[model samples]
Each structure stands twice: as C-alpha cells, then as structure tokens.
Target: MSAIEASPAQQATVRMAARALGRAGLVHAYGHCSLRLNHDYLLVCAPMPPGLIQREAGVVVPIRGELPDGVLGEVRIHQQIYARRNDVGAVARSMPPSVMSLSTAGITPVPRHGPGTYFAPSAPLWDDVQLVRSTPQAEGVAETLGHARAVVMRGNGAVVVGATLEEAVAFTWFLEDAARVECAIRAMRLENASAMSAEDAARRATTAGRVIERMWDYLSAGDLELNSSHA
Candidate 1:
C-alpha cells in the first residue's frame, strides 16, 4: 500500500483503538490515537471525540512534514514521536481523570502495583500544561517520553506509545490504573506505601502469556467493530 493509503483492516484497528480508549474512560472529547502505517506515515482517527467516531474515519498523515489540512494540530505529537521512536507503532493521547489529577501535583505514578510495573521506576513527567500544538512543543513532549511507555503532562493528560496498537491501548489503561492507585494512596495518607523494587518491577514487567493482549481484549470487548471480521 502507498504511504498515504491505509487498508480497511488498518483503518478498523485505528478506529477500534480510539473507541477502546474512549470506552475505558481513558479519553474524552479532546484525545486522539494513531497507528504507524510505515516509516513515512501514520493513520490518525477522526478529530471528533473518540467515542463518537464511527465508520471508516481516519486520515493518513506523513510522519515528517506539515500536518495535513484536516488533521488536528496536536497530532504533531504523534508525528514527532514516530519520527524519533522507531519502536513505537502506535500512540495514544488521553486524559484519564486520575492521571490528570495526579499530574497536577507534579507527580507521575510510582511503581506500586502490578500494572504499574510496566512503567518501572515511574513514567516521565513533561512538566508542561500547555497543549502541544507546535512542532517544537510536540518534539519536547516526545523527548520527555524518551524510551518510556508513557509520559504524563502536568495537568494536561498523557501520551502513550507501544510496539503495537493493542499494546499502546493496554499501556494507556495501565498508566491510568497506576495513577488511580497513586491517588488512592495519597487520599489515604499512606505516604509510606512502598513501591516495588526496581529488580522486582523489571521481573514483573514482562509481556509474557498474552498479558497486554488480554487487557486489550477486555477493553475492546464491547466494540462491535472489533468483534467483526474487520478487526
């Protein structure tokens, strides 16, 4: 396929990932998701709220160039990340409530639980609340992410990347769950709640036995498109 054209299955996967992020409460009206089509392009979902997207709605965007006419401005975040991280096949920009709430305190979730271990020591913090609309701003966000699976934007939400679209979706959920736990710990005043050791977190962070796939299946289970042949 050409860099500008995505097959039906690829388009369906992008739609499914967007909807899953929405249904899981990880995103709302302002978020977007994209999957890399190749080294040169990516397919981003329609600009509307993720949950409200329907049919084959996506635009193929070049990885290194001016944003396409109809693409959202912040999609530059995806473009920048795709340009820097060849390992990342998909990207999600989400506003999970707990993640946003925790980030406001200048904190990213600690590795205090099983799902949290995937992020290990902690997800990096962008320390910026501004929307990443410019190329420079998007580059800053992607640089903050580095080799991490996710990066929390202070009071702005988060950006998650994965080796595949499913892994990206699963990691988005995991990041939020970790933040939820962190919020609960703070609420209970458990300031001493111990975090998993780096050694232990590394051991537990493996993607063995369909760990990520299972989470993706659970999150996308109710999507009719994913259940159909298009999935």
Candidate 2:
C-alpha cells in the first residue's frame, strides 16, 4: 500500500500510458482501456486511435455501468470485469499484432516475457476472449484476473487490471512492449539458441511491477478530477 494520491499528474501519466500503448503497437480503434475510480466509476479511452486515445480525453462511466445510451458498444467489455471482479481498480484491452497472432495460432500469451513484471503482473490466456459476446465472458475474465494485473485474451486480445488507472495503463504499455520483446526473443531462439536467464526474467518482472505501482501512485494522486464519481 504505497501512497497513491489522485491528482492531475496521475491523470497525465495514465494518458501517457495510452500513448505508449500505441507507440508500442498496441492500438486499433477497436481496442479500449479503463481505470476504476473509488470502486464506483471509471475513466477510459474515447473510441479513438491509440495515439489519439489520450488526446480525446477518456470518457467517464459508473463502475456499475451507468453509461449513457449508444456509447461505444464494446464498453460492455470493461463492464464485464468491473461488475464481477472486486479486486481490480482498472482495466485495459488491446489487439496487438503479436498477441493477435498468438491468439490466431491458438497458442496464447503467457508471461514468458513482459515489460518489467512490476505490478505483480501475470499474463494468463482466457478461453472466450470476446468481451461483448456474452455477459458471462467478462465475468470469466474478471474471475481469471481476480487479483492479478494482466490476462491475454485467447483468439482475441489482451486485458490488464490494476489497483488504479496509472497501474492499469502501465500494464497495458508494458505488456505490449513485452509482447514485442517476446516475439523477437522467440524468433531468435528458434533461429539459434540465445536467451535471457530465468533469474533475470524474474528479477525484471518483480522490479517492473514495483516501479509501475509507484508511478501509478504518483499519477492517481495527480488526476483526482477524472474520477467519475466519489462513491
């Protein structure tokens, strides 16, 4: 439990995470990300390009799904997790190339690689990844992501959960970056045999998780205004 205050700086950091996700090649207009606010509401992407996601200033909605009618249809994707998972405070979804490729191959994305493994992240694959398919799918994801920070959608995409918006966005960016690294490392290993040691990987994950957590704390403390509701 580090000091995570809500302030403008925290919001900006969350915004930067969306931009980073795009820069890391985790954007598609269809993908989305969200941050839970005080267990009552959340702030999320505004149906724009990953790069523009931050520029548009994310939309705010109830943690209990009190959004206005006719908003992004995929919004339910997030609702699924929030309604069922009590531990998470934020959520993110992405259709990154490597992840999609893995999903298509039916192989799934596991945390064999990651940005830093900070935030106590774990990248598990879900069976039915489509968020809007059924109300139950989201619940299933929420269940899998129970207390963890990340889950990659099988044959679909990826989702990252956190204790705050900053942590969620950090997880999103880092996961995409890690996916890229994993894809490259995997290719190289297949070609030859070069690789990073398990010890190094574990060390990085632990360090990365803690760093993300602190940065998230700083960001949330700044973006106190973006909170959808005090609840």
Best model number under TM-score? 1
Model 2 over residues 93-170: C-alpha lDDT tens digits?
Answer: 777777666665555434444463532333666766455555555567767666666767776777777766566766
TM-score of 2: 0.68
Each candidate's clash count: 0, 19
lDDT score at residue 138, model 2, on the 0-100 scale: 58
Which digits, one per residue and each the tens of the lDDT, describe model 1 over residues 57-156?
Answer: 7999999998878789999999999999999999999999999998999999989999899998999999988888799999999999999999999999
What's model 2's lDDT at 51? 59
Per-model TM-score on C-alpha atoms: 0.96, 0.68
Candidate 1: segments with Cα more than 4 A from true spot = 1-3, 227-231
Residue 120 lDDT, candidate 1, scale 0-100: 83
Estimate the TM-score for candidate 1: 0.96
